[model samples]
Target: MIPTNRLSSSRNSRKPVCSRAVSRRGLIVAGLMLGLLGAGSAGAYGLCPGEMENAGRMQQRILREWPLRSSSDPASRFIQQLGVFLAQYGDEGIPWRFSLVRNLAPNAFSIGAGNVFVTEGAITFAQSESELAAIIAHELGHELAGHFCADSYSRGEGDIFMPPSEHYEVGVGSIRQSIDPAKEQQADRIAVSLLQAAGYDPHAMLQVARRLPAGGEVHLHDPRRIHSLERLLAGYPPAGGLPDSLTFKEVRRVIMGETHQR
Candidate 1:
């Protein structure tokens, strides 16, 4: 309903270049073009004129479409706390807001502007805090790396922030976008760093990747992605840095209970 893409790692780009520089350059160019050619021309770069304003509108539109769990819910609070905790190690400029979507599908996604949502099914799917953290961290990676802008430009989608049509379905497959495979791999690498910095077992990301169904347009084939993650993990020491937190266990229990009742 947010008109956003789901999380699934794919493609193997052995070289991890600094994408931030590319993003910044693209934005600057987009800005210049907007000034010269006006708002209509800016869409050529996958940017809406006044991105921050569009982001706000986009967030509002998504909230309207999706049924989010109340913020007061314990499970919702846990997601917020975990997202904020992981965010501290990354970009401090973006005001990251994490929310629990009421959907039962095991998915997570970020609609630009530091907003991340994890479905109830995804929470239940994760076996531990670190695994859940991996999902959140990966979404953060997408935001931090400016994937939304780059992805939009690549596909020539012209303002991905636009509201969805009335006929849109509130299903996982309906909302998921197939991002470039290279960008997906880049996000995976960034998630590893975020997990390590947050004292989570970096391997937790790999674990979740393995559990995901393979050969979807949104995800890389299992073997290639697994091999890439394996190579990346080889650089880190073999220490399980942290265990699942009691908070996550409780939150998962509450969410599972509510899900069953529904």
Candidate 2:
């Protein structure tokens, strides 16, 4: 973890990373290498605390126990870039490590402090970049909100995606439940704000809610979730923002083996 920098230059005047709009997303993706600077400055943002050594140690443990897939893959790098970009708006104290796992279940989770892991299935299932980014934003919301800082999870020290608790914080000796319903809603709300503020279409979250199947790891039920999300964005319907990327499509093609030859 290092110093942190502001995501936009000033709320009013944002400097796009590219001269051409088509490559703007690519530029943002590349700019993340230096995005983690300017620590202790986001007080108004309240992203994270100034120190996170404890959370850092836990992140190491999770990385050690679980085999992480290489992020060199374009699709994987895209996901990492999304997380890093969203993170730039959060606390700099958080290292914000992103990883792609081999699991088939469409799941995403964050643990310790700033570790966000997305499953291969999630990538394959997401129809567009916005839908995928919405999911990532939700998971990152969990980390930013300090849900993992719960006393039970802090010492439990078990794999987060397991039965009982399942996908994003299972219990150790005992079977503690998964993330609280209230917390899920809170994350959803926070995610919308984060996505919108980051120049992403907030309604993309609603699109994801419709695509997900019922049950395991799907919180708040789709219809209800959709209603709430729609209301939240009612005031701010989609306007110009980040668009679906060919990079995302190509990544999907490589992972899903679907030809874009047409």
How many backbone clashes does every candidate have? 1, 7
Query: Per-prediction TM-score, please?
Result: 0.72, 0.68
Model 2, C-alpha of 80: deviation from truth (Å)? 1.2
Candidate 2 accuracy as TM-score? 0.68
Error of 2 at 197 (Å): 1.6
**Please, what are the lDDT tens digits per residue for candidate 1 over residues 144-254?**
666655324323323352323421112243344544545566778777776876789999989888888654323434566677889999987885968878989888998
* Candidate 2: clashing pairs of residues: 3-37, 3-38, 3-39, 4-37, 4-38, 4-39, 5-37
How would you encode candidate 2's per-residue C-alpha lDDT over 52-143 as one tens digit per residue? 44456565675666556687977678788888877665544455778887666677776645778887778888877777888998887676
